[model samples]
Target chain A: MTTGVRRRMGVEERRQQLIGVALELFSRRSPDEVSIDEIASAAGISRPLVYHYFPGKLSLYEAALQRASDDLAARFVEPKEGPLGARLLRVMGRYFDFVDEHGPGFSALMRGGPAVGSSTTNALVDSVRQAAYVQILAHLDVTDPPARLDLVVRSWISLAESTALIWLDGRRIPREELQAQLVHDFAALAAVSAAYDEEMSALLRRILADEPADGPFADLVGQLIELAS
Target chain B: MTTGVRRRMGVEERRQQLIGVALELFSRRSPDEVSIDEIASAAGISRPLVYHYFPGKLSLYEAALQRASDDLAARFVEPKEGPLGARLLRVMGRYFDFVDEHGPGFSALMRGGPAVGSSTTNALVDSVRQAAYVQILAHLDVTDPPARLDLVVRSWISLAESTALIWLDGRRIPREELQAQLVHDFAALAAVSAAYDEEMSALLRRILADEPADGPFADLVGQLIELAS
Candidate 1:
């Protein structure tokens, strides 16, 4: 009789089980295509039980997306011990591995929905990613203020995401080759972007100290510094 | 009247008119919301005549997208003009101008499909963009092999598209501020990306010459080089 009744599971275990089932379903189909009934049937539970876990389809989808994101972040953001380049390569290796393993899930999360629809999830992902970038920035000795950090972080992530997506869309590239290219591509771009900032920041700081009045190039430099920050 | 009918309205002029009308409609409504009839009506033309000019809605959208792309490319890729840094700045400014002036259309294209059900349009935009990137690489004096050239072009385009979208989101800061950040950000990243390519390509060329059994990295790099071409 006890066995026939629902098995009592801790909240974390229950949530994990649901996420596992949800990930399997989402991988097989798109977020919009998979219904609550399918998730319940697959999970060996009643439909209402699935709803008890997640209130609606969007909620379920977001959970599944978060699971995938968490999985990737876990692999990608390890505090590996090495030189900056090697450490970055390690992080990127995990990143490439996750994408290679879960292409569809990654696409759905990164490319799906308007930004406003799931701002929370987006923020969560962005924060995890900012930590990863900061790790690399630390290696590079980039101690820019918060605003500058924001600019560089956002810029690099944008570069990395788009480059990865294009390669994923049957660009017919093998995983190892793509990963290598990504490493080189990202590392090289980071150097250039940092150099540009350093040059502009120096010029702008000089102008700000000496000239309060807006000269011809002062406004331009100020604007450029604003951007770098 | 007979002479006017026979005379060729410059292909460029006709193309401009079609793009202008399509951009107007796409700006106010989501791409799915706008239809051929509306575009024709807005342009003061018969529906059939619009069809004759554009073939279909996708073609019209592609034309509008292309026009925007051309405007942007013209602004950025000024060959025989200036250093890579200056050229890149001009290009970034043009992108900011584009978003400021045609916010919705730029948003739709950058946001990707469901705003416009036209992969063809996306591809057309990509091709024009790839060409522009190639021009920029040339201005930077990159003398890499064709395969390497492809990689440089692709990675650069990725940087531009990603930066533009991030700015358009209008979340982090004002548009004006974001635009300046973009210029500084890419200038740094692009220099790094280009520099890294030099190292990777040299490594790849040597490996290919050795013709040793390909490892995972070799295979992936080979596939990426192939795809880029």
Candidate 2:
């Protein structure tokens, strides 16, 4: 039995192993710089095996990008039991961590680099954004937000992405500081949007009530009052 | 004299004309795809003439990118006579106008495409950002802003660039509405920064005082007060 031992891995398990190897390679370099032979070697398998799992290198890249996007989207979900600010900070922490770990891959996925030329890649990127939007709405306890509020949320998502990209490009600020700034930015945007829309205003009021008194939310409110006065 | 009207153009004028023609072509295609022969033909001049002005295609691209950056930096300068909100609105108007007229060029310049490999091109892009930063500081009348305030301004500039890129990608909102939202977002970011820095708080106070009574600033203040009460 020992002499004949060749563990039979299931098809799905083998496919996943190949994708895992590809993701590791992509996280360090651009898709174009990675090759099927390298991925196969990394997985201790043959190039033909990789091709069996994925038709070509582009298929492997798409699979890896999809997995990365899914992982990123999953990180946005945090427990709802804490103060809104704390919950948001936790979400951002996870986000920054992902960016730190998957720098090249995160940037490639966000940019939709020239290597990715399929509609499926675009859809994958959009799905990541949509997933974030849904989670934010869920955190706000808003199932049916108004169009203006929806726009504000979507804009904040873009801002967060841009901020992360810049932050990663240059570690100008401490990671914790960047997270706090982003959280504060989201609240401020929500407050500003509330100025023009009553629905957003109501949502802000609800969200603010859940914030701890000594948290960033209180500081923002205090600053707003001082500025206005 | 009429027969001698071969129009002896000066070196500077000829250079500017070549750059202008190149900008128009670059606005429609990537730098890698645009050729020196095409640029010369567009300018109604011989290819050697373009080479005489710029050493090569990369040199021409760098010159054109520098010109676009300078043009963009100039658009951010609005007279400091009106309300802060109004002044910002005017600045954004000019910016949107530039983006409108130079759609592909604006996107290409901001992205710093693959063709822009020279350090000079990087410096040109940085100069544009630095000019905007200086103009913003001057508008706030701050000779030396706090580190936090400085970071806020830099981050807002990134936000503005990303927002404009997305706006160009899709006309999701009316141009005027998008401008107003960006201006509002800037103010909101300043307010959020004020929560962490006293200098920013003071600057926010000074800027808010210049906002008109029925403007977005007033509405934001009114909403804050209503929410707090």
Stretches > 4 Å off in candidate 1: A1-13, A113-117, A141-153, A193-229, B1-96, B100-152, B164-229
* TM-score of each model, paired residue for residue: 0.55, 0.70
Highest-scoring model, TM-score: 2
- In the range B118-221, model 1's lDDT, one tens digit per residue, is 45564666666767766765664565634434554565566666666665565454555445444434343332333335554343343234332332223323
Per-residue lDDT over B1-229 for candidate 2, one digit per residue giving the tens place of the 0 to 100 score: 4785668789999999999999888878766678899999999899998899999988888888888888889888888887878888889899899888888767765544565334576577668878989999998888977666777777788777867776776665577877887888898888877766677788888888778898767766787678876
- lDDT for position B5 in model 1: 62
Model 2 residue runs over 4 Å out of place are A3-11, A29-38, A46-52, A78-83, A111-113, A116-118, A141-144, A209-216, A226-229, B1-71, B79-86, B99-151, B162-177, B197-223
* Cα-based lDDT at residue A170, candidate 2: 60
Q: What is the TM-score of chain B alone in each candidate?
A: 0.64, 0.89
Tens digit per residue, CA lDDT, model 1, A45-150: 8899887878887777777777776676666555545334445556667877766666665565555443222556656666667666666555545577444445
Q: What is the lDDT of residue A217 in candidate 1?
A: 24
Native-to-model Cα distance after best TM-score fit, residue B95 in candidate 1, in Å: 3.8
- Looking at model 1, give its docking quality level: incorrect
DockQ for every prediction shown: 0.10, 0.26
Q: How does model 1 score by TM-score?
A: 0.55
Per-candidate TM-score, chain A: 0.71, 0.91
